[model samples]
Target: MSWTDLTATDLVPLPVVLPLLAAGLALVFARRPRVQRVVSVVALAGVLAVGIALLVLTDDRTLVVDVGNWAAPIGIDLVADRLSALMVTVSSFVLLCVLLYSLAQGVSEEAEEETESIPVSIYHPTYLVLAAGVCNAFLAGDLFNLYVGFEILLAASYVLLTLGGTGERIRAGSIYVVVALLSSIVFLIAIALTYAATGTVNLAQLSERLPDVEPGTRLAIQLLLLLAFGIKAAMFPVSAWLPDSYPTAPAPVTAVFAGLLTKVGVYAILRTQTLLFPTDPRIDQGLMWVALLTMLVGILGAVAQDDIKRLLSFTLVSHIGYMLFGIALATQPGTAAAIFYVVHHITVQTALFLVVGLVELRGGSTSLDRLGGLAKLAPGLAILFFIPAMNLAGIPPLSGFLGKVGLVEDGVRTGGFLAYTLVVGSVVTSLLTLYAIVKAWNKAFWQEAPQEIETDARVPRGMVVPTGALVAFGLALTVFAGPLYSYADRAAAALRDGSYVEAVFPDGHDRGVGESNETIPKAGAPAGPASAVDTGEGTP
Candidate 1:
């Protein structure tokens, strides 16, 4: 179909499909670096356009598409709501910029030496696959599809993480693969139990049936899902893999992984928490404690790190607690803030890692003891790093500060000893975050050189421009916070209300254009103000 002839439902899968198609074309053109670059860029740019269009289209409505036009509870489906739309848009922007940054890195490395450490033939296809996986996760409408998305990305990441085959990269990749496989196994078990209980793996269907399920069985399923998502989201105790695993990859790989991957996990938790089990306060309450501990532990680790990438990785985990803090509230304002925070973080964190890449290039190392006088050497780079660093530290008038304030206000309104304590923990984490960032700043940019730093290698303009564009995008969030926050509020309302469910099964029954012999059992809607089910009816 022509673009002009397509409906909103038709736009639902392009973000996932475009990348996979481009990945195949990229593989065919792998022998020609320029052709591969063009294909990758054009494909991601198309995805970015589609993502923005979907975001605008889904502003006031949720769109669902059953793959191959087959009915749900049997065939796979994709859903585009405000939450998923916003995630796709932001993640596409990040993915596009990181791709450009990596391309520039490759061109510059080739110019600098005879041997290229980054293999272009392997990089383009894998990166596009990574993009497809991320888009798939954001748009997935069921548990098994979500698991499929995770595996796609994990498989791509293994290749990216071990790109160089060096000892450190190999070791880090091994650790990462083991942890990811374990999480996948746990998630698979959770899906099995969910299907056995509800008779379908469709998320909208589960929202109706899960309430009638035995409370103990429901809780077990909820906790298992949380355990799996928590490991992926890198929540405290389970977050140990992130700091070590991320810092070993190429700077661009690390940037995208740190920026988009964990947030995908957080998005899963937010979707399932608010939609599938909003009535259950037991898990929400436990999430509050986990959020607090993750904040404290992650920031403490950040403060101790001298390597810039590892430091940023720890801070990445630390700031995730803020998103969790908002999710744990299970209120409209809290979720809106969490959604807003997710946007802020994806841009800011990715920009910071790209900047660190520049630092490594200019200074020959990422360690504080090995680097100094960067401000004098690269003033533009200094400005680039400083802006995002301060924003990350939550300085006034930045998106980070605004997002944190929203979370704190809601926490105070939540009004329990734990809520108040989380409020306090949020403040302390921000302050400690400032301390860690400032320490990195002083040591790397302002402190006297520990030795004579190499000044011959020029920081690539190709790399700097993309990095700067991302930094500017983060700043734009601060400028646009009012409208964006309002959008998030509406999105949160849709999640809290039954609008998402209503949109999926418009007549209160299983829906699609194709036939399914399988039947969805009818069940009464759960009794609660928080439940998002509108009808107890099921498809027959």
Candidate 2:
């Protein structure tokens, strides 16, 4: 933590800055598809390298960068620690995977329609920019910086979602765009309200000032923020926009969306709850109710879908509820469970979606009725789909199972009656999710092929590789869960203390999370003061 030690190689700025610069360069070669691919891919590789460096170099400590030499609370900043770094690592991996898949897709589709292909030039450039946006959001320190990062990603997604411009694509993309834009607008409004009410947008400053706000004011701010983020995270009633929109995109696009977008929303909620309002005797119960509803509702949707992609989309929404449930539990282990679950979900969900796309390619459609006999036709594809599907269903010996165990155990230990009921609901939802996957397998692989169409023989090897990469990568998490969980534990501890503390108080003081109530306030009105938001995943 010396001044000279904080170079560009330092943890704080490199992850976001490298991607931003690379994205700009990629856009320069936007007209040249091949060049754009190289620049973007190389840039994302750099991001992954930087992310690894960030994780290794931190040693469970915080790396704070005060932008332009400004002190905390006044200057914009970035913090790279275990939580942010873990997210950065996962996102970079997912981005690189999707980028490769997209390249393969461009080649495959271009070759197929050589006579009249729809010129997929914009995809490479836009995708790189989108990746940068996601990277920025994950690492941002201040609220407005987070907003900028979100806008960058969302705008890029709007175009990517509708890249094909087909009737179905256009319709789905429009809904996605409208919902996202409105959510962004609401987010902006909330920022304005918070800023006007308390003169700082830096998270740490608000963490200090938020407790002093009137009860009515705090509730208003909290509800607006939750509504905005709930929309983004696709939690419960707000999640309707995800299913119709996601499945309509290209395979790579869908994978990235499934992997990154809602998770970003979940990340946002994690920050807000831990840093801003950890628990309110009143507001938290409301959030818990929403959490339970979101989990049940999403799985129910998943069960009802006939199309493979659509079913996964609903599952995505359902899983978000689980993450929120961890957040709602407001305990160290619960939060840790959430952190583990987020990592597990990103890899499992993306791998599963990619496998579905491959299955569709080989079979011509992902509908339960259209897909059949794939287990015999392509054993490799089956293996790829089977592992991740089991993981997603939370089967044993997988990271998914471990993450759920952590969360459910935490809930029962500290959550009392509400916690136990929700735990039951969570278990049931997991079972339902398993049922949906089993149905898909039975219809697509176990059952015999109904009708024959010889034109598109097997899913190309290119598509297979990217997906296989994800599954193999996901399996690594299971194998290495111990160290990763330790890191996640450290990360959960750091984040709940408020990431931008120096920005809030330039003296650079530390509040020794859960011990200092003088500096960090709890959830209440202007007059009431509670304990610091309990952010560690398992801390009792």
Clashes of 1: 0
Weakest 10 consecutive residues of candidate 1 by summed lDDT: 524-533
Q: Tell me model 1's lDDT, rounded to 2 decimals.
A: 0.87
For model 1, the stretches where C-alpha displacement exceeds 4 angstroms are 1-6, 107-119, 510-540
Error of 2 at 536 (Å): 15
lDDT of 2: 0.78
Instruction: For candidate 1, report its TM-score.
Output: 0.93
Predicted model with the maximum TM-score:
1
Q: What is the C-alpha lDDT of each candidate?
A: 0.87, 0.78
- TM-score of every model versus the real structure: 0.93, 0.90
User: For model 2, how does the per-residue alpha-carbon lDDT over 1-540 read when each residue is reduced to its tens digit?
Assistant: 224344422556766777678767766765676777788788888888888876665553445565775545566667665677789988999889888887876742542353244454556657777877887888777789999988988888987887756788789988998998998899999999998888778777788788999878877888888888889899978888899999988888899899899999899888888888876857767777888899899999899989999999999998898898888888778888899999999999999988888887788888998878888888888899999999999999899899989889988897577888889988999999999999999988889878873544767677778888899988999999999888777777776665335323433353322433233232210111111122323321
Candidate 2 has its poorest 10 consecutive residues by lDDT at 524-533
| lDDT by residue for model 1 (229-293), tens | 99999999799999999998889999999999999999999999998998767788899999999
TM-score of 2: 0.90
lDDT of 2 at 480: 96
